[model samples]
Target: MPPAVEARPRDVRGYPVPAITPWEGGEPRFALTDHGRSADCARQRRCSVCDVPMPPGPVWRVVGATESAAIAAALASGEPYRNLAPTTEGPGHRACMLYASMVCPYLARPNARRGSSAERPDELTAHVVRGAVRGELGAVVGFGDFEYAVTETQVLFRFLDLVEYLPHDTADTHLAELRAELGRVR
Candidate 1:
């Protein structure tokens, strides 16, 4: 079971708040990250969504299958996958990440874009955004041993060893197919 909606912290709009969500002058900036909180969660091994200590086990992440496949391809080819592709988001508990995917507007809407192309200035950032497939296709729930690292501008997550993956919506057959393809390559 997931945490009760009311039990989680809320933003001004009464939506369950994520630990990395930023606030500007007391208003939630859903599109932005709070770097300080993000770093704390990473260093302390806490859930990015619930801001609680992660249960002992693999950390979970909600990812786009397209991006997962790309990483898998890069890894198989002996490319520097970690440096070439770092997840801007941090890891969370399985339940927390699942719940956030269902409730967060950006994650819940399949066709929504992160922002204009201008917002994604670099090729890597743009490529990452392309992986944000959601809704009927759902998202990939990845379980892995991960560690935290800080770049000059942001905290990054690197999955040291991927132990498992579960598609968020089993009914989304497309996601299952994609996951299977990723399995073949990874």
Candidate 2:
């Protein structure tokens, strides 16, 4: 007689859950809650940022295809989130906030700074924004579209794309001047 095969448990979605096996180091460590893990799975079931759900079952796409390559390039170069800082009494603030909201759902109101002499950290600082996300994620830094969590040791870059808006008159323009300063820390 042939040996019997074991069955797996299914979740609410009717997907089989593989049997939990002990790791070489011992019990597995999970960083996210059950609900959060479910949400992450759901997000992966669809487009990275879109709401539409993908069809059930296995599907494949070329990782470095045109669209994927574009996204990868954008994320790698930080072009998508650059130059979003606001200027005084202008559309820059609104535009930045709007763009940020698309990536970060909990983005707070814009906080402006005048000079480096300020003691408190600038609220509009991207690092501060990243900190808020880290706090909510229980210190885990997961990076995905519409969500972000990264480790302290990980190199994170907040690109402010102001190249187009920057003035061409001077070699040491305001935007160039600010970027030079920010680049040092990263």
Candidate 3:
């Protein structure tokens, strides 16, 4: 079994190297995100975590806490409201999911119960993008400060307005499959 998650997650070196490196596979992908913030981002669209150009179509990303405020408020107030959903990050790769799920506190910690929030949701949410998303993508929180915390360091995004949302049920279910894939990697 994979080791249990610690109270705090630590970075593992040499992680997320693509199974096939550019040397072996061909060119590394790089492109500007549809909502990228900087010219630099436009020139180089890489996973902030692994610095890889995310492959096209079907990647996951979580909406920032601020954007989820409505969801939280609704959950807290017990009122039904428009679901403020987590959206996909602009074009990026998902190769880092296993390592990320292992070490990222924002993700399910090691040994997170199968049914725990670590596992399920109407929408695909990752501390970072790990699967595919469909819906009104909220904001593209690009450049921001990395806030250090006991559990892990987190990046806070500068959010934009609510965008179109894809039907929750219609969202791709790749996250569930990816979660299962972690068992093999671990």
Candidate 4:
């Protein structure tokens, strides 16, 4: 009989590691990453309740295209998103979704002057981009502070919050499937 090959682990940058995930039965278990650990440490230092060591890992969730698009749009629009603040300095709970049912009309509103060119939409675009990044990060890791850029076609989905911590090959495969599914909806 041939021996089964084990899958290797990869870092955030896609470099290979021995194996960050622990194996018990046949499945692998992931702990927190370095960034998560640092955040936990910072939290524990300030909060009286967070005295224990933090687990460095991510929690995964599968979302629909509509939800994903809405989130992407929000990030690109630059609205202020909500996140948790540490009570003292300990790790806080995970972030929850911050949704706005309708798109803000500020960007598409008509200019007052009939003859003049439409009002510049840059301000609204910037606001939406900022807000989306803040909000998405808040929903993922409980608290996040990252800046993002927006584009005309679709929002750039580059926030750490949007990152899935699966193995590199697995993550790539999943992304491919997601892209295909998204293409079908369009």
Candidate 5:
């Protein structure tokens, strides 16, 4: 298989690049995510990046303010919650998610917006845009246990005990470290 993913791959910028992330013309498409693999990761309890079993503890999801708010509102409602739902991007190992949040261009930038429907007219892209919080506020790392909730249309992750939310920062320190590494390599 893909080397068992004991250790995940990293891009030049030192970001944890997901195994299922798309590549086009030999260049990685960092903006796009693979929905099939996302579902698989959630089902198998595997790390989205490395495709390995997650270590014991909470699973980590990179979420924006919109998702955070939806989750909070659903929890506050008190009745059985299902509509709040999950993102197509599945939970991953904490380190993997943290590294990605710190260095991935889209996640690191607080104001980066997705391309419009006119630009990317695909169902998956549409889902991504709909699920994404417009980049007005920064992202957060959410940790919890999740179970699949089957709906009439699709299956989604229903998080349990999702008590932790950490701020996702832009990669100033990581970019500086990358630059230093490049200087040494040269």
Candidate 6:
């Protein structure tokens, strides 16, 4: 008899695929965001911020201690929450949160001094907002923290889309610290 292989991941139609295995080493794990190896996730990209699948294009990546804190608070509160800027959980429309990433206090951190390494120890380095899709507000993440967001809890947003994918090598405005990290390696 042939050895049975791991069951193929099921396509939930709207849900983004979750990683069955985590990054074992310090390399990097893109699964934390919409960047997964699953066929559905690849076939259609969803906005990490709005949870709305969209045409693969340019999306906004949110960062900074404040945004992080808000996410933590939102999860802990366990209430339908909303923000003017992009959320850490998903991709957002460039037109929706683009201006925020460019001006958010924590994002800019003008007064904050650059760390010695220039590389931030706490991030995937980049998030790409790909193509677009117009779908109903399926569901909102439940309760959780920076580690993870609860699935199917809130009813705030409907509609998600894919904008893009940010490889470890590419750095956007959110990755200001790691902007030229690869260049410095040489």
TM-score computed on alpha carbons, candidate 5: 0.61
Give me the candidate number with maximum TM-score. 1
Tens-digit per-residue lDDT, 1-186, candidate 4: 000001234345542222122333544322211223334334342111112332454222222223345455655787543322111112321210101000111111121111222123243233322222222211112223222233332222122344322112112233443345335533
**Per-residue lDDT tens digits of candidate 1, residues 1-186?**
245334667776677767888777877767667778899989899888778887667887766546556555655786644433567778886666656665565565566555423243454355435334444344645555677687666787777555544444432333444445435533
* Index of the highest-lDDT prediction: 1
Judge candidate 3 at residue 65 and give its lDDT: 38
Candidate 2 lDDT over 1-186, as tens digits, reads 000001323344543222221122433221111224334433455321122243443221111122234444565687662323221111112122122222222221122211222122344232332223321111101112222222222211222222222211121223333345335423
lDDT per residue (tens digit) for residues 154-177 in model 5: 435656666555543463434444
Model 4: residues with Cα > 4 Å off, grouped in runs: 1-22, 26-67, 83-186
Error of 1 at 120 (Å): 8.2
Clashing residue pairs, backbone N/CA/C < 3 A, model 3:
5-110, 54-92, 54-93, 60-129, 60-131, 135-165, 135-166, 136-164, 136-165, 136-166
Q: Each candidate: RMSD to true structure?
A: 7.3, 20.3, 14.7, 19.9, 7.6, 18.6
Alpha-carbon TM-score of each model against the true structure: 0.69, 0.17, 0.29, 0.20, 0.61, 0.23
- What's model 3's TM-score? 0.29
Per-residue error for 42 in candidate 1, Å, reads 0.4
What clash count goes with each model?
Answer: 0, 6, 10, 23, 0, 40
> Stretches of candidate 2 above 4 Å error?
1-39, 47-108, 112-186
Q: How many pairs in model 4 have backbone atoms within 3 A of each other, for residues 3 or more apart or on separate chains, i.e. clashes?
A: 23
For model 5, where is the 10-residue window of minimal lDDT? 116-125
Over 1-186, each residue of candidate 3 has an lDDT whose tens digit, in order, gives 123222112224422332212221333322112222322222454444344454433343343334445544654686654532323233223334333333333333222222222122223344323332212312222112111111122112222322321112212333454456455546
Instruction: Report clash pairs, candidate 1.
Output: none
Tell me how candidate 3 scores on lDDT.
0.31
Candidate 5 C-alpha RMSD relative to the actual structure: 7.6
Score candidate 4 by TM-score against the native: 0.20
Worst 10 residues of 2 by lDDT: 135-144
Candidate 3: segments with Cα more than 4 A from true spot: 1-42, 56-59, 63-91, 95-101, 109-176, 179-186
